[model samples]
Target chain A: MKNALQTVLALLGEDYDSILQAWLETQKAEGVRRPDLFSDRESRRQLGDILRGLGEGISRSDLSEGIALDADSWTDLRATLDEVTQERVERGVSPSEMATFILAMKQPVFARLRERLAADPTRLIEEITQFSRVVDALAMHTNEHFIEARDQVIERQRAEMMELSTPVVQLWDRVLTIPLIGTLDSMRAQEVMENLLNAIVEHSAEVVIVDITGVRVVDTQVAQHLLRTAAAVRLMGAEAIISGISPKIAQTMVELGVDVGEVTTRPTIRAALAHAFRRVGFSIEKVENARG
Target chain B: MADTASVYLVEHVLLVAIPDNITDTEIMSLQEELSTRIVSDGARGVVIDIAALEIVDTFVGRVLAQLSSMARLLAAETFVVGMRPAVAMTLVELGMDLHGSRTALTLSHALRALRSEGLA
Candidate 1:
């Protein structure tokens, strides 16, 4: 019981350079090393950072805490893993590929430990178990962080998409338009209503044309969201005019008994704008003598 | 948050100031009490001041709309005023329409609208 973790630390500390070299070679042998994706200097730097953090972590950790390393004592190790995983996830590297980088380190370190502990089989088993557990923990930790980072990336992208889909345009001095371009899910519907209402208040808009031309279909839920948006506008003392109702959508609306409720509907944005202009008391007229 | 309906009769108008948190039972009783007050007192208009309310869910929204409709049936106009922007947004997302109810930005505006509509 010579403290397997401390022994591994000594082994790693004494020949850190060679262990990194062996680790890099093992990565290349496993066909996971992509020099094109990561330069030799970058890979070497990451390995150096990992080895340094591992050494520092092992020194601070209490091995009697069993195979599980104390999470608080491994802050640097966690940081390194987070950084590596975040970059890899952003770069479109697969989880397995990211895990491979950490797991590949095991071969070199194990080979070194086996050679050094060849004289004693019981100590060898203990040391191998201790070393493999550390590697597995690090690999598993990296995978977990990678998944979290990927989910964060996805969530951010979804928010960005919601904002992009619900663009509020100022069509006139006191008239704004929101042209929804996708399926109106509850989340997107909320986003649409908030953006449209804020715009209405900001402009003191008298008329708002909600153009759903780009929207795919009008289900009961979608109709409800539209009605809600219009109702909010009316509540704000502004008239909400829905435009771009296709014949099919209109039929669907009638069938579903969906009521737009005192809000005017137009077949197109142009017609809605005309109606908006009329509602705001700005009638368009054709001037004479441009036909020469 | 007050359980009893805090209704004030101001110049032939039922002035109802809704609190921040009201239960369904309270809302129902409020509706009953206001309708009775409107009829018995000969109130010509109602101005619902929802400024104290931060959030209005579907039930509250439906209740507000229904209250206005009830007032209309009694020949009294209803003006719902002081709706916070956030509350309005929540109401819209919940698909609550204050049907045939006039909305004003402020209590003064509500009174003015009722006056202009010839209800007061």
Candidate 2:
């Protein structure tokens, strides 16, 4: 096993360029190349770097003990693939497409080993299995990194969207308004409370109108989050008026037994604003005008 | 433990700023001191400013609620002021209601709310 692996490593070190060229040909023939999504030059460079790094990692690796690539010994290989995965994820490349690209190198490397080790069938089988395992391990590592990078991208966008969605506005001298949209989770609830409280202090707001017309459902968890926000607002000495409770939501709230004690609820933002104005000692009267 | 919370009179209202590093014993003594000051000085309102505090465990929460109820017995309104949003959320999550005690965003707002309602 050791001698067969040494022979394969020797071949890779000696004829690295030819195997890499064969792999590129296989990749192109397999239609893994997508020029429409990005420039082919950049993708080719990433693949080339990853192959070179993988070759170096395998040559120095001790495959006699096990086929798994030790993370510390394969730092360069991991770094190269990490860059490729990050770029591919940013370009919206599907995981299957990435898998296909990484898997295409297997056939070319296998063919090279066959040509060199076909004299000994048993050794050929052992070396081929070891080489295949190494390739498989690298592919799996790249795939895992691809998914992690994609998740990080999504997590970042979610955070940015949360900040964009929760905007605290001041409707009057002592009134603050937060028009909620989409689902309300615990983290978002915390964000809402923080933003509202900061706005209250910033504006010295006495009344806060939390409009939930954009919210589609009010489940028990969502109700609890809303109630917590209201309680936090009250702790700040500002009245929290939950507005725009559709009939559907009101029914859901009752079914859920979500009691919003002392937190005023209104049917619409307009009504809530009026109530807030009244609470802050303001009243709006209709104006009568004559044409001049 | 090093320094206790001090209750002072500001505009005929008791101003109790609970320091962040106060010990449990200090908290009790501070509550007693507030009671004594509220009665002897004839304070119309009591504002407990806790904005600098990061956590209000169940014990501290109960003390604040007790202080409010106790102030009512002395004919003085209790307004907990400057509660951080995070602290308020945690208190709710911990199932502590502060028992219907009045809360304000700042010292000034606490004073204004009490004055507007004729409690201060």
- Best-matching candidate per lDDT: 1
Query: For residue A84, what is the lDDT in candidate 2?
Result: 85
Task: Show where candidate 1 strays beyond 4 Å.
Answer: A5-7, A34-41, A59-66, A71-75, A111-126, A281-292, B1-83, B87-98, B101-120
Could you report the DockQ of all the candidates, in the order they appear?
0.34, 0.57
Clashing residue pairs, backbone N/CA/C < 3 A, model 1: none
How would you encode candidate 1's per-residue C-alpha lDDT over A71-176 as one tens digit per residue?
7878898898789778778878888888898999988888887888899878778877877888889999998889999999999998888779999999888889
- Candidate 2 Cα lDDT to native: 0.82
Q: What tens-digit string does per-residue lDDT give for candidate 1 at B70-108?
A: 999999988888777688887765667677688865677
| Residue-level lDDT tens digits of model 2 in B1-120 | 325676778778988888887778899988888889988999989999998888889899989899999998998888898887678777877877676588877888788877887766
